[model samples]
Target: MIGFLNIIVIICIIVFALSMLGMVYRVIKGPTLHDRVITLDAFGVTLMGMMSLVSIVLDTTYLLSVIMLIGMIGFIGTVGFAKFLEKGVIIENDRDNNS
Candidate 1:
């Protein structure tokens, strides 16, 4: 059973690596900001999957915190990029009006 599990994990890692390569290509070759942002988000998701697989193979949960941190960072980055695309900036300049 452990052998079968190992094989599955190895296959998953390979698939994630390939997907990450594709995402990198898109990030580099994409014609628009939105496309690049989407690619980055996809890359982050693939990274998270790979991390999970590694933790599983190692039989340790020590990477859980790292995984969560990566997820949050990815989410925030995506949101910021999306907002930038829509408004040309992530944070509005409310201070300018107050002054």
Candidate 2:
């Protein structure tokens, strides 16, 4: 049964890798910035999943924290990109408004 589980995990990892490759292609060839940003977000998610799978194969939990860190960074990056796309800047200068 352990062998069966290992095989399944390996298969899943392979599938995730293939999907990540597709996402990379989309990020490079996407028609617009929005498409690229979305693809990047998806790529981050795929990366997290792949890391989790690796942790499973290694029989360790250390990678879980790294996965969460990746998720947080990915979320922040996506939000920053979205804000930039909407407002033309990620961080606005409040000094200009006060003047």
Candidate 3:
């Protein structure tokens, strides 16, 4: 039943929202930077899922593209943040003596 499926989707989206609320708390009062980073990653993933669920609810596929783009950006950001947190740098310096 299409109606039943829609209900299931709606429930999933609601759950996603509730999870993000907890993540937001972690983001605001986390004791460490790593905890904040984890919360951010969770929040981003939840947003991407919410975008997909919205597209489904609206019977349109346009939001799918946006979802993918946002997901990729989130992944890249997480990687860069982790690298910086670990080593204090993202890109390595080119050591050359020529000036």
Instruction: Give the residue spans of candidate 1 off by over 4 A.
Output: 95-99
- TM-scores of all predicted structures: 0.91, 0.92, 0.87
lDDT string for model 1 (1-99, tens) is 579998999999999999899899999999988899999998998899999999999999999999999999999999999998898988996886966
Judge candidate 1 at residue 51 and give its lDDT. Answer: 98
Q: Give the runs in model 3 whose Cα sits over 4 Å from its true position.
A: 95-99
RMSD of each: 2.2, 1.9, 2.8
- The residue-by-residue lDDT of candidate 2 on 1-99, one tens digit each, is 569888899999999999999999999999999999999999999999999999999999999999999999999999999999999999987876866
Across 1-99, the per-residue lDDT of candidate 3 in tens digits comes to 569879999999999989989999999999999989878988999999888898898899889889999999999999999999999999877567455
Tell me the deviation in Å of residue 12 in model 3.
1.3
lDDT per model vs. reference: 0.93, 0.96, 0.90
lDDT of 1 at 28: 94
Q: Point out the higher-scoring one by lDDT: 2 or 3.
A: 2
